[model samples]
Target: MAEKIIKGIVIDRFNFRDFDLIVSLATNFGVIKMVARGVRRPTSKNIYILNPGCLGEFEIFLARYSNKLSKLKKGECFFNLDLNDKKIYAFWKLVSQITRETNFVPKIFPILEQSFAKINSKNADAIKVYTIINWIKFNGWIANLTRCRVCKTNQRLINFNFYGGMECVYHQNPKPFFRFGRKELEIFYWSSSNLNTFLEKVDFDYIYLVFEILKQFLKQNSYIFL
Candidate 1:
């Protein structure tokens, strides 16, 4: 077996047997599950590295079936990510949402790592963290939240048709389509902005609203709530 190290975020966990855990990790390669024996026990030396949000250097011994599902030979915590209680919960919520919404794990790992680093930073702004998440949803190759799919307009009051592209209210029947509010549009625009100053200046209410909108959008399209 070849030994290798990979950094990842624990997206989900399930108890196996006798203090062991099966963790689903979102790594740069993709979503991979690994068994961490004895991780649940208080005396387990690997306990520190098995946490949900911790970015760690996992030493994996590639079993023939490791690519399918197997246990790592050993693991170590590279970054424990000392976060406040609120931030920790928020981080976990974001991770859970991401895991639920899409299967494009490999592509999202870089963005996830960046978000985690920001959340763990001493000067990290909660609003900025929220903005980063919203930004990725809009700009990601998979989602592409910008520009109406039909008219390709950058207008705020977009008419969302799940199958077709977004249409401007003027271009479509207003009653049937869902409208993304001005504030919500601003949040998306600001989230995708290149200026770091805008990220820091976003209001909390708008941030929360953006999250709600994205969650609803995901639910509408994929029947999944993030």
Candidate 2:
């Protein structure tokens, strides 16, 4: 079998057997699952490289079978992101949401890589994270968060249709849906603006609210939350 080295993020992991693991990784090529032999052993060198959120450089042996399961031959940590407890939880929440919303591995590996780098950065704010997510959605790749689909206005006082898109106050009715106040809209706009400005001045509270809104939105769409 030909050996290959690849850079990837540990999106998920599960025990395969006594001392072995099956890990789901989002790599530059695509999402792939690999078996790591003896990874659970106390003295295993690969144990440190198998953690979720860790960026790794891995040596893998591709199998001949059509199922595409690879064997992890070796791995090394590229960067062990130093996230505090609160940040760690936030990171996990974002990852969970992303994995659920997306079916296939994204073609934009740079975006995913940048997200990981931002989440790991010491200077990253909660609002920055929120904005990044919104940016992705607005780009038409994830979800819609732009003008009201009905009213066609960019006003902040908006209602989110359960199906998708936003609605302005003019189109608002007694329909069962989620609404965003002016403040939330301001936060959303600020977060989704250019990356540099967002990173410079984003609030934790504002970002937290956006996160909750996104969670609810995803829930309404029947996405799994972890």
Candidate 3:
């Protein structure tokens, strides 16, 4: 078989014994796993390129027996990414944890790259929130907040159901779910707008509100709590 090269970001990695590793990467092609031999040794040059959030090109050998796994032969870093900030570090950790292993999404790689670029800037927290919101949207996990999920009419929705969506006061259930009002709607509107412009207008506080709503939305849809 021929060698395959791919550009991707290291999203997660695991140490195996003394000098080997199992790495999980997100590329335009999809999420992939590979084995890196001797990377943990003190003289290894591949260590920097294998860290989570490092965007790079990987040269791998495709084993004839199993195409699902690859042997990492070489790695080249695309950019020097700063992952030392605790906030940025935490965000990447969460991303690695929630992302499904072996699932392929063509759009995920570019989005991850753009997100890391933004978070590396001075407005790291705000961009982190933006990235999370975009992640949810890219995955199609959001519910329509502008109209009623049942009646298909635009109204002031007062409640949200995990299975259903936004409900008007007349249609809402007594049990606890999510409650929305004018303020929440405004936040949703802002979140849906252009990210660059939206970041200029809203601070982290407002973004956090929207983030919490998105978190709940994700929980109901995928049963995964972020």
Candidate 4:
């Protein structure tokens, strides 16, 4: 067997037999689970590089069996997210979970890499919203927010639909499971229009609420969520 070098970010890790670790790495090739033999030991050289949020180039040994995960030999970290911060860690955990659960969609790794680069304290929440929006769009779940899917009118756009059309929640004829008001409507408008303006103007409270709902919707669609 020959050593193969690959570059990726460590999305997650689980301890194996007290001394080893199984790492989920998001790479250009897609997410792959590899065994980091003896990484749980304090003296292991790959310990820091094989943990979550670490972006590194790894040398691995390909498994002889397709069902078995490859072996993580050694690696060097190029960037590392500060997992010590609970909020930031939670955000990243959601991202990794999405990668783990969602089917292999083309170009998602690049989007994830771009998303990680955009996150910071100053614009973390905004970036998170933006990233989720992209994920929703990429997975073909985002519906038209500019107008009513049935009536084809932008007026009274209050209800949410996960299947591609949104109805009004205020009307008595039919009730919608996920609905939004004028404020949320405005947020969705900017989300569809200008991204920069959306990030700059989105209210924290509304963004948080919308984020939660969107995440739930993703979960309902068999995607990943926090």
State in Å the error of residue 145, model 1.
4.0
- State TM-scores per candidate: 0.67, 0.67, 0.69, 0.68
lDDT of 2 by residue, 112-157 (tens): 5655566643444463355345534643634345666665678754
Give the clashing residue pairs of candidate 1, or none. Answer: 149-165, 149-166
RMSD of 1: 4.8
Best by TM-score: 3
Q: Worst 10-residue stretch by lDDT in candidate 1?
A: 135-144
Instruction: Kindly report which residue pairs in candidate 3 clash with one another.
Output: none
Candidate with more favorable, higher lDDT: 3 or 4: 4
Overall local distance difference test of candidate 2: 0.63
lDDT of each: 0.59, 0.63, 0.67, 0.70
Backbone collisions counted per model: 2, 1, 0, 0
Over 101-182, each residue of candidate 4 has an lDDT whose tens digit, in order, gives 3555544666556556656666666666766666666678656756666666767667656565455544323545566766
Off by over 4 Å in 3: 16-18, 63-68, 79-83, 102-106, 143-187, 190-195, 201-203
Of 3 and 4, the candidate ranking higher by TM-score? 3
State how far residue 49 of model 4 sits from its true place (Å): 0.7
